[model samples]
Target: MLTPKQARFVEEYLIDMNATRAAIRAGYSEKTANQQGPRLLEHAEIAAAIDAAKGARSERARIDALWVLQRLVFEAEADLADLFGDNGELLPVEAWPLIWRQGLVQGVEVLELFEGYGADRVHIGRLRKIKLDSRVKRIELIGKHIGVNAFRENVHHTGLDALGDRLERALKRNH
Candidate 1:
């Protein structure tokens, strides 16, 4: 049976995959979390708990890695030109879908514009635009999960190859 602290550590570890941070979050001493995290992961009970939790989460969500990749790839954005009105002003907040509103609206700023009157001022609106999250990065992450990479061809040698090369050089120098 896992202790309460160990159970908490396993839960936290699943959240971020950082053992030290998980230990700290699980109420371990900050000074010792760095060491405790790795040690807890090594415990068989904790490991099993984490694996079981991950399986349960996957079953509940009914989403696999492929589904996540597909969703990221298919995040269709609305036309940027349509976001503005005929007067070149941003449309009302309710005009776009929630996803569009979240991704396109970087920020809202209200500017006080003074007219000819001394105490009267009109509030002007400014909407900052931010680029949507890059599809390239999302694709890269998907490729990583799928064990595919365009740059893998560039890496020619395995770890053993480098060690062999070093040994050959040492032997040649000795001879």
Candidate 2:
């Protein structure tokens, strides 16, 4: 049971998950939307409604954590060799495996080669550069998904007591 405005806010929030923008779009005053948005989220009923909507959307899209992890793993393990032939020439897009073509390749740049300039220009050949998605980045994401801090550096912290002890030791040495 939501008021029309609240319902509208929920709908707009689903569009981008930007609560303040959603509040403004739902007819709230822009000046107060920054406060109003988070306050609305604090309501148990509103939170429940948002959760239900998210669950429904996830179900409709057939996407879950496992699905995302699988995709990340595929991208992380993508092989560059798959994009080239035994002769060491880059394969055409049609020849590339479907998974690599769809998920690994980020973009392609083509440079048309020509001889001469102006009207005398003759088409020679083309140079293609294929940009692949960052495998290291994908691996890092997979590590994060599985709760492995593979890419994170260990941070060591010294307590105040430890610092005090070190200072006393230094003072004794000086004395």
Candidate 3:
């Protein structure tokens, strides 16, 4: 798991921009992108992990990216409070209930909407922790995913649909 700083550095450099600028944006000192980035990048495994983690996943399934990213940051800094008990999941205790409740709501919605589709425990579990942002970002990133066509396109409807669809599906699944 790469730290947020490390993730930021890679995401930027991968943009094909100047290395120094990318490094500075990542909060490194004095043209350190060359020295810092390459060293971190050398952890090829970490790079692959970040790539897989950073791919275009839905906001319904990825809103927690920042949470996970922060967790990774905590792991990197070795500063996570022992709040999640001995289980080693790096989330705060107080936030879990609220988060899980939201996740349940999302799962029900998904199951309902995907009525013809089957949603097992594991799949729902994975989908539940997906951040609210995951859905939102799926809409936003659609433009970034496609190159020139992105500029020509805009997506106001995706947001509306995610909300309505998720809710409608949840209600249907309840029955």
Candidate 2's TM-score reads: 0.77
Ranking by lDDT: 2, 1, 3
lDDT of 3 by residue, 1-175 (tens): 6778777877676566455666777888865566875666567865785466446433446655566555333333332233245675535435544434433223222221232344542332222132222433443444444443544556565588789999999999999
Candidate 1 accuracy as lDDT = 0.76
lDDT value for candidate 3? 0.52
Per model, state how many residue pairs clash. Answer: 0, 0, 12
Tens-digit per-residue lDDT, 1-175, candidate 2: 8899998888889999999999999999999999999998887888889999998999999998999999888777767898889998889899998888786888989999999999999999889998877888888888888899778879877698889999999999999
Could you say which candidate leads in TM-score?
2
The C-alpha TM-scores of every prediction are 0.59, 0.77, 0.26
Give candidate 3's error at residue 130 in angstroms: 52
> What is the lDDT of every predicted structure here?
0.76, 0.89, 0.52
lDDT of 1 by residue, 1-175 (tens): 9989898998899899999999999999999988889999999989999989998888899887778766655543345666678998867768756656655455555554544555665445444554555656666766676778763557555699889999999999999
State the lDDT at 82 in candidate 1: 64
Name the top lDDT candidate: 2
Candidate 3: regions farther than 4 A off: 17-20, 53-175
